[model samples]
Target: ALLGQQETNLSDGSQQRVTQLLKTAEPGGLYGAAGDLSDALPYRDRPGGLRAIAQVHDRYILAEQPDGLCLIEQHIAHERVLYERLNDRWQLVPLTTPVVLEGLNEKQLEQFERLGLAPEEFGPNRWAIRQAPEPLRDRDDLPDALLELSLGGNLDTAQVAIACRTAIRNGTPLDLATLQTLLDDWQRTRNPRTCPHGRPICLTLSESSLARFFRRSWVVGKSHGI
Candidate 1:
């Protein structure tokens, strides 16, 4: 499904791939570029390589590659980036004004605390956050992450779910600067092909695969969210 009504998330391909290609770096590791692809696509190059040209359907980032064009799913691309980034060992950051979270059961509270959220019982089924992981703290939507975390059964699953919640959603339209920055970060991720949850991040429609192709760039602004 392109849009998930329950969580406002997007899911495609019910079949999850068994093979996982995680970065070689340890947990909490920062990934470097994977270098140029063998197919002569410079999508990973920083100084000069694939260039952001347009956005398609206001969801996919359109970039110009030597072979043809690349369509990167913005949501999954950011999801993968956030997922890998959250994979690193967390650095706790205390909030200026402690945040309160609700809708968590005792078990969920324990699991939330286990993820080192510094959870405290505020009241009946309410938890307060004394400190948060560094990556999560920077986000304006800490509550969103906490809400998503409440559904997690374990640390890893919770982290992945939190990343999905925190990442830029599919309908968001990013400016060229934002798209370029996102692409740079996406290229740096070790597993750019598929997100941790098994959704495709980037799709290349090479010249060989296209009978005809046209690039169309829409206006970049808030009214359109492009």
Candidate 2:
């Protein structure tokens, strides 16, 4: 399948040895069998030259590399994906309840108004979740979450920070189906490059970049060396 390629090549003997090693690397031997067998088997193939393959199983997402195995928090990935989608789709669903915020000083209120949220939308005394965005409907703790945000002075930046925290936390585990859905949604995002807080959502390292990290070309005094 040629998952990836490298400038260096393994000898025929080494390739044969790797094939032999893979024969014994059964479902339980190295990478556990959990997801669809079709997706699982080829990821463990020897001749494919895979650098890594990450998959979500029943209870965990595992990353397999030649050096070692790693268990990743699938839920965090799902949350990031979901949050990105929700943020993009915000205008699609109007606020179900008009949220009245209280406790904001004049400056805070001014900031909120500048951001397009009116005092009426928030309600009297700066308190009340008369309506909330649809994505947050299923989150039972949302009211309390909004209250905390209001208490903190209703600064626009602070409000966004609170929304991010309420969206999702790291370390949640997701099933294969959920992971697939999350990834699919993520691909659809216009700026899948970064999260709402301006943090990078994912990173990519090409073969050339990896070679520089190891100073491979530098050792040979090549033109493109590190």
Against the true structure, candidate 2 has what lDDT? 0.45
Model 1: residues with Cα > 4 Å off, grouped in runs: 1-48, 123-125, 138-141, 211-226
* Candidate 2 TM-score, C-alpha based: 0.44
Best by TM-score: 1
Q: How many clashes show up per model? A: 4, 14
Model 1 TM-score, 2 decimals: 0.66
Model 1, span 1-226: residue lDDT tens: 3213323432443322211122221122223343222333345554335678887777999998777777788998899888888887646788887889877777777776788776888988777888876767777888777677766677778768767877898888789889988888888888776788865566566675453333223222323664
- Top candidate (lDDT): 1
